[model samples]
Target chain A: MADTATASATGGSEPAIGRGLKGLLLVALPVFLVGWLIIYPIIAAIVSTLFVEATDGVQFSTASYRFFFSDPYSRANLALTLWTTGVCAVLLLLVGLPIALYLRFSTSRFADLVQSLAIFPMFVPSIILSYALIRTIGPNGTVDILLNAVGLPKIPSPYLTPWGPVIGLVWDNLPLTVLMLTAGLAGISNSAVEAARDVGAGPIRVFWHIILPRMGNSILVTISFTVLGIFSSFTLPYVLGPASPEMMGPFMLRTFNDLYDPLNAKTQAVISFVFCLFFGIFYVWSIARNQRSQSR
Target chain B: MNRREFLAAGSAVAAASALPSLALADDKTIQVYSGSDNNIIDFWNNTIIPAFQKANPGMKVKLVDAGDDNGLRAIADRALAALKSKADPQADVFENFDARLPAGGVEAGLWVTFSAENVPSYGKINRAAIDMPQQLPYRGSQVLLAYDKTKLDPKDAPKTWEQLVAWVKKNPGQFIYNRPDKGGSGGNFVRRAIHEVNGRDPSKFTIANFSADYAEKSLTPAWAVLKDMAPFLYEKGAYTSGNTQSIQLLSQGVVTMVPVWSDQVLQAMSQGVLPETTGLVQLTDLALCGGFSRLTVFSNGANKDAALKLADFLLTSEMQSAVITQIGGFPGVTWDNVAADLREKYKDVVPNSIPTFPGGDWNAAINDGWYRNVATGLARG
Candidate 1:
């Protein structure tokens, strides 16, 4: 690995104009596409959100913000979305960590199968899952049938309530989280583990101190992606939520598209976009900060 | 070649190009704006458009699926705004609901004054329906109360508005309808709530303050009926996805009773969305029929002749029957063909009553500015 690295280092030193152009092409192409398509859309949505107004003709008003904050029901929905996402993230991290560790350390085929199942939900469309879950737990559905067989109370439709969407989001996100977390654990240098064993440290202590720290980048990556996946989502909340859970994304779409009220929808969309913007900036700062350390 | 020969060649080229344009000027295509769904558009393509095509081979007809009621309104708004700014109107045909035509179309001058000159068949449509606000050209169908025959015992079936309410209270969440703000049926339900509530004549409803909100306050009896019946709605007062979802729930036995417009159920049966066992039922005393509206030729279009011919063909007897038998929707234009024979053959598959407006145009659930205010109220609630 060191010799190939040296050869590449030497290769790069050669004064080839085409190689410099190739390097420029490689970096610039991806940057251009990502900026123009993805970043521009995000920026456009944020800008459009600011244009919404109240009937009094108070242009550039914060009436929507006041309305959202004043409504206890809407507040509860926001709190519910946040709480559900946080809980689901923690549960996924806890449950996924051990499975990831086992897959890294164990030779059992069953553990391998568990790894596949853990990641399977990512491939299945979320709407199909919501439909299946609804049918399973909806009144007079399979869950009710089984419960009646055992003399148990029947589960209601939209069984998760404020957290129904969270459950769906977590299920969708777990596969990617497990795959990433497992890869991080598996990438642990064998020499480091052996060195710890040679010293006075035990297996659990060595893992907590070394393996987990080495995995911090992966952990942060998981958190960033899971936050993104759960936030700004609409379909799950739209389908699985109670009659009106009022998630930022779904609420905006319903207001704009269904109700034909672009003003309120744009306002809500803008609020949600601002949150996304802050989160995105934090991610960029983290990546840039890490790059500086690597450069040093 | 000589300069004269070259000049002659150029002249011939220009004439060849100019010939097609002149032919196209006389034989033009009328662009009709429709807020109806693509399925209904497909019904026109398969049934009505062909009938029009057969009659006026000299002209062409174009239908733009404007998407929804607001979509139609927005299209009209754009055209009117353009016209005010001295730009050409894009669509030759203006088709939309009764509520919007008068509010936006006629008031804005995006439409021509209704005269016997363009549409001769205007006389054939029930004069009362023609006098309706913007619904002058056509009368589309809206749903009345309907139920599953297999679930409803014939003797036990609801016959009157009061009896229906009483029966609904006995079975609550099993009753379902689309949200009014969501679809046309929702508006129908809001209007019907008036009849069920106050014993006041529907004619009094055309006056100011007779909005559906009035139905809420004045029609305490109807609300009382609904309050008792609410408990029995599908999934114990849960909403279906929308109209389509409500019907799906009913067909699935997730709900037993739902209100689907006259055409919605028939269209569903055609599309196989619902089973054959489902049947149509309207409350006695012709529960508030929020009739569907249709398209008329715009005065500002490039192809007026072609458009008028197309409009005429669509209203003909052949086209109206084709709409009834093949794709289910209430006929906007009258047809001699849609008489007793077809009704007897199809039985209750079609509505026993094709609701018409004798008491002026069937009053919409709410007029323009009034509806916008009430909508905010519904949302706030």
Candidate 2:
């Protein structure tokens, strides 16, 4: 408080720097609480998952890692997570591209409304969306009601299956994906687009040759954000997901709490952190690298 | 005053308003911690608290449903830390038990012995209910077999472990139960099964030595049965959702029957987690394990005596029954058989009795048998 007061007395960029620090603290306070409650415990679980004994002060080993993924249940779960991510990402690109473009060119009020709706998922927290999806698709839930209306079999929720988590992941990541794509599309120079149209180029040709080339940097931004969102999401998948092929969050929990094995949990946490760290670094780096090269 | 100070002061005031007047009372409100559900907490608050408080007017039972067993365990850790500070703990009582009980909690003065004389209907509780200061619930949960009669039909279902395994072989994935290390309910099943199957003793926990590995090897028979039962699981040998899963599967018609909390089965029926055909069974040679989810009052509780009084009230007969009705809180203390009229609504659909876990074998079961076998060490296979 005294330092901030001193900075304000200086009444220049020093005050601005102090305000920035205050803003940083405002952000950091919640992050610390969230980290303690949701993040660190999860990290503890990962550490626990790496070692076999899970006993306190035990050294790290790959035994748990070997055992967990060696079995049919764990093995099947890994495949499920990978395949689901791949399929969902492709599906997102296909479905999200049109929505992104529609919002880019049209200046109509309806177009703006559509754009808002497209990105609404970003504002809607994943936890709320995940629950709503589960309730809707759960066995004997609303989906079944619709199925019955269409004279279909009473297909129960695949909630206990891997696909259940997939829907949650896509729903959570989609809004942000669309948001990034829209930003990229909107960033294309209007003058260049107008010149192309004035020179008798068709709209489709213009979009493919000029607008797309110009917006390459934005598209990369969308990919980077989407990948980051998918990699880091903990809640939507953990709750909606099945016990088999348990993700990093659930596995970490089992190690530290149920197993009472912190060493292994810490190892697991470190490994997960490493995985996310590398993936994020590569993603961000690629976006920056692309932006730099494109400026040429 | 500055806004943050004002808010912090307001917090203290709110805390003060919520505090019970303890100055003139021998017994006062006991603050409780649990991982149990809100519905369960509400059940304790409305039905259990009033009954105990009515008898001991000075007592008001305050339950803070922290989360689940995990949340309760964390609260226990915090209280233990506060005990070190030689100060009053934020939490008065917490509910949980695991490998940490003997080594971590009980030995740590996080627990003190609870008595029946101080508790209402303590004498009526079976000897098996008092195994350790830790396992005994002020309220006990019974580990009994719940079978879906529609699946087994006219054959009168399995009456013994041998019969049950045979049934599982005939109808794969028709029967299921939880793994022990996952939670206490399953751990109870493992212990009960060991006592019934191999005649192990709970009081004799030591095996040539106190090494956990020794305990692990001692559980061969129980694991052998589980190994055979494994192939017949609902997911065909996948890890189950523990006790709760079996009840849900019974409701979904996925598995015919499995072991679960007797109260959970009843709650399942109430919540529609179990189908009507599903009912509980206590075998003639039946063995069942029981554990307490007690209101464990920490020594450094803010109001220690008041907490003790609240704990005492919760253990009373009237409060136990109230816990039974709403929280489906199982009664550790013996009560008059619930009204025959009430039984008729759930009796045939539920078990006639909670299978008694062998009193003679808890030590062997928990240490080498249940703990070693299912929890820490899997059978060599």
Best by DockQ: 2
lDDT per residue (tens digit) for residues A69-185 in model 1: 786655655655566667767877887788788888788889879988987998899888876666676546687789989999876555325556766777888888899898778
Tens-digit lDDT track of model 2 for A152-181: 997746554566767777776778778778
Chain A TM-score of each model, in the order shown?
Answer: 0.80, 0.69
**What TM-score does chain B alone reach in each candidate, compared with the true chain B?**
0.77, 0.73
List DockQ, one per candidate, in order. 0.10, 0.16
Which of the CAPRI classes, incorrect, acceptable, medium or high, describes model 1? incorrect
lDDT of 2 by residue, B278-358 (tens): 667754455565555545556667666666666655555566656566655456555453444444554433343444343
The candidate maximizing lDDT is: 1
What's the true lDDT of residue A6 in model 1?
86
- What are the RMSD figures for all models against the true structure? 8.5, 7.1
Residue A269 shift from truth in candidate 2, angstroms: 0.5
